[model samples]
Target: MKYLFAILHKLRPLFPQSLVNYGYHFPKAYLAARLYGNPGADLEIIGVTGTDGKTTTSTLIYHILKTARKKVALISTVDAKIGRKNLSTGLHVTSPNPFTLQALLRRMRSQKIRYVVLEVTSHGLDQFRIYPLHPVIAVLTNITHEHLDYHRTMGAYMTAKLRLFKSAKHAVVNKDLPLFGEINARLPKVMFSTYSLHESSQLKPDNIKYFQDHTTFTLGNTFYSIPLTGEYNLYNVLAAISTALLLHVHQSDIKRALMSFKGVKGRLESIENKRGLHTYVDFAHTPGALRAVLTNLRSLKKPAEQLIVIFGAALWVVSLVVYGKRLLSNLIVLKLST
Candidate 1:
């Protein structure tokens, strides 16, 4: 990507237009309508977004919805599975083109799928790729600093995420974040529902418990727990469970689905845990993502236990950090507060 950018710089003089210059660019919805028409019109699109856990939540939602025998088209970072057309992440979908997204949604709609769960990223939202699909249920996992360069500031990054709730009829959020109240206050007309550590008195869900083998939680009179570990998964699972119940999937089915879920790839995934010293790893490369994983581990740690953090990055971010070694050290000491 850096090499491509360097080459583009050299050729900038010959070409008189910016690489991404779009003149009166058609909104994704319009392009979607023109090419793929409208698939999300009848199907409920539940958009899941945040710094982390989106893939897990989305997969869980897809499982429960699929278990209930509802057709679903899923577009997540892990993969894009629309009906029988399931493809791996290696497929061309890192920020899908407007027409491609519209076509996918339209395909799902054509298959008579009842639901679609799209994992919306800040970059995808910023690009107006999904402008056509007005989600019925928007699930915001949580927000933290991740895409600072692209967004320029945390505020702009947040604004990109808020675009999900802009058209959603019911927005589900993790109200535990410090920014939750501020974010909710600025949104458009929508019925707000929240999933949190603190159970809402008005909401149906009452007490919740996170267990090693299975997490048992109650909403109204019924108790539910899927076979899963990690406290973060519990919260993310609940977010999906809450959304599923709201969609009126049977409590028994929901319970069954969670119990049987095998889990998603690369999410707090077990790599190699040696004697007492667990070397658990994840695909967390961004500052916010690193913070989220660290926070979860910190919460899970026993008192007096030491938590060691060694930072590294993917190829691109690694280059950035390597090139800006002095800046990185200064920022770590001054700007990053944990």
Candidate 2:
């Protein structure tokens, strides 16, 4: 089966996409799940999917659940956590293949974890890499221009994202995006709990303020001041809050979790120094994410200080065209390399 998978991967370009997706990926995932006793079946999973903010949102939800003293695990692009163990899923992989995923779930099951926050990608959903592992709660951060090489069109990409919500008992969505209307129209409205930074939503943050070190926002009468900054992160926080609330976590626990949360690694990570230099390292590869990161950094810089950006591109990722356009407009340092 491994050899056949290798051969199919090599000849993938010649075959029809549907065949590659269903015939190859789906069967492999199905077999792997069966082999592993379908460990995900015993877990209450929270699946977070979108072009960006998936890792941050998933981590936030995991943190909240952990703080609330729920037996929770996490699988994101960053890494996977099972009880006290931290496992590396893979490099540059959002959702692992079925075998790896099933193994992780099995480990989680052994640890008696009751809940899991899994980050889902469009490619993962389309290829059925996480087959038969239905999420109890599905969260859609937002859809944007991403993974066009595999999906070929926005409609197909959206369709892939829609698959996550199909089986979920509840969905927490970002109502600010244009995709919200289509999702609301297609899916049952009662299944949805929404958050928005703009316009009305079930979870909207009022009196929002952004700072270099942290951000403050209000949801109803409760005030939240989180360590993570940027307006983009506010959406992530709200999504996490919505999911936590759905799980029946108290507002006080949520606030405590957010306040103590240091933030996701390699995501707006800050380097502290006494030399009056503000430097951050982030894994913002997408155009939309890049824009948001630079915008946040620019806001923190003084008028006389220049924001130096040393841009690096991964060989497998093709984001240069749109990425370059955004960088050029910023007039910052554009040191490009593959």
* Candidate 2 TM-score, true structure as reference: 0.92
Per-candidate alpha-carbon RMSD to the true structure: 5.6, 3.1
Clashes of 1: 1
lDDT of each: 0.70, 0.88
Per-model TM-score versus the true fold: 0.77, 0.92
The residue-by-residue lDDT of candidate 1 on 198-310, one tens digit each, is 64522434455544345676766877766665556776887897788779899788888887897776666655555766455566565555555656666556677766655
Candidate 1 has a TM-score of 0.77
Q: Which ten residues in a row have the lowest lDDT in candidate 1?
A: 16-25
lDDT of 2 by residue, 1-338 (tens): 78988898899889989998988899899999999999999999999999889999999999999999999999999899988888999997999999999999999999899999999999899999889988989999999877676777788889999899988999999999987898888777449999988878789888998887999988899999999988889989999999999999999999999999989899989888999887788888777788788888888777787787776654433565445545443443242211
Choose the strongest candidate by lDDT: 2
Per-residue lDDT for 239 in model 2? 95
